[model samples]
Target: MSDSLFLGIDSGATTSKIAAVRDDGSVFPSELLQRPTGSEGGPEGVIRAWMRAIDEYMAEHGIKWSQIAGVGLAVPGPRRSYGVLDSGPNLPDSFNGWNVEQDLISALKQASGRMLPLALGNDGNMGGVAEAHHAIGDQRAGVVMLAPGSGLGGAYIDPTGMCLDGDHLAGMEVGHMAAPLHLLDVPALTCGCGRTWGCFEMYTALAGLPDLLNLALPRYPDHVLADPSLGKKERVLKLRGLAQDGDALALELFDLQAKAMGLLVGQLAMAVDPACFVIGGGLIDPDATTEAFRSRYLGGIESAALAYLWPTQRETLRIVPASLGEQSQAIGAAHVARLTVKAGSSVQPFSSTSR
Candidate 1:
């Protein structure tokens, strides 16, 4: 038994996942770990809690920490240059100045009594890397991954096998980009960060959709309060059901979401004509292939690209849902860990600060 098992962990707002893989990219369920992430406690507590979960999994498998080659952690926030997390709204403010990347490596080394290099990056970046490696296989050139869920996250990989970790480690912060608001007539909605209108989270995110639905609620009061499955799916299924039931309001909501997403795609296409646009998240239904995210969003962008900071090119864009679904980031973390260790380097965690 080689003690070269690679590990990857995904730290999200609601839940955290850890996975282990062999050097050949073969993953084993016996090596995977899942647990809740206590985001409210802030970054340090969350990391500690997750570390406990990982410890439990390792113990159950009778696997010593020393057996691990390296660990890769994908965090929900941006990467910091000096091992710190710049900002994460869902986390407590105590996480400020937390150097997530360095801290994890230190903890692992301390626990194992061995220096296991840790690799870190933004959750989105690792998700893109993971999805591309899993889905596209060897083609690493220019690929874009769009995550549409609680918030929007975008990751871009260039032709030279270089992942965009940024100079300050804040690469691919597209969720912060100002996506359009096709449904809102009001002055642009502000983000929790207190920015003015047109923020990305305010447009297509899970948080944004309910507010958008509320705007249409007055017209279709029946569905707002009466739908049995309303709150569970964040009213997404309700909106879709209503659309199916000929509720004008629901149809309007879906149409609005589609249009806004389309516009976003168009804008993204101009910046990098990605080989494939991998869409992943809770909202994207893998079964709903006919939705044509690229066509719809690119169409919107084609109409509105001139107004954009960067013009778009629609001819070469292909929009597709990520095949890995919710597990992309975790899988990618494993891949990254294995690659880093094989290269004879320590893995870089997302940040050095606790948050």
Candidate 2:
């Protein structure tokens, strides 16, 4: 078992990342591999791109399928079952009815000529698992993770580092959760989830940035970001650079983001009473400028959240950035695969109809 390796794949709409982990839960970031998702080709093409990334990684590192103990794949969107997705908002319509887990398994067998144990999990839940056990290493207290990327996603990990998926397996759809819109003093905006108003993601995620900027741009006509030629997404992405340069409008946007995040965390804290809350995803960058902005933003969140909590809760609650950074999802998926194998579940030779 010392030499055994578990493979973790984080399959996102834009990119697919792969990493191998040892039995002891260690992984080399240098060995991580990725490829464009190639969603234009549909489900089969996306899976093939992922498989090619794995194949190239193994060949480059001299790894063989015989030494691999298990595999885990993390995917986005709501699940109808273990490996079947109900719909993928960021993915092409062709993938809506696909059983991604079974397809990946068949592709693996064809590529590696082995039926390895595999586990499929939601990307948010897998990130929580990694943060709870490997990154934060707090096995005694429950952990909650809120990842703000193109959209917001979350997961709850019990004290034992197991993710709680609930009866429907859609338990942690935090993005669609109703928020306290009145707290922000802004008009309620509809979310992609079809909520008429007040979805948390509508205030905090990248998808929501355009609306946020729209509200701000009216007052800052002279600002460089206010140029009509820059698309909404481009303007949103450029806000960070402006914030880095101490631009007032950009800083204000981040401040609003912090307050919204605080409100979301406060809501979760009251409901779940988790010991710690970890913030991850694209918004939480490791670069110096981003780190400085994140530090200030976190301070604002803490202040806002503290106002909503009792003294005891305030003293005990912890909010921190994700330690594993970009590698969290992949490392977490590998960790889940290892756990599945340890539970004595048979994942190899899986049937298309099976979980």
Please report the candidate that would top TM-score against the real structure.
2
Q: Candidate 1, 186: how far from true, in Å?
A: 8.0
For model 2, where is the 10-residue window of minimal lDDT? Answer: 346-355
Residue 68 error for model 2, in Å? 1.3
Candidate 1 stretches greater than 4 Å from native:
1-3, 29-32, 38-48, 59-67, 78-82, 159-162, 180-187, 217-237, 244-246, 286-316, 342-355
lDDT by residue (119-220, candidate 2, tens digit) is 888888988888877645635788889888778889998876668777677888888888787888777878887887678887888878898889988899
Best candidate, lDDT: 2
> What are the models' TM-scores?
0.75, 0.88
Residue 157 lDDT in candidate 1 = 66
* Per-model CA lDDT versus the true structure: 0.66, 0.81
Pull out the clashing pairs in model 2: none
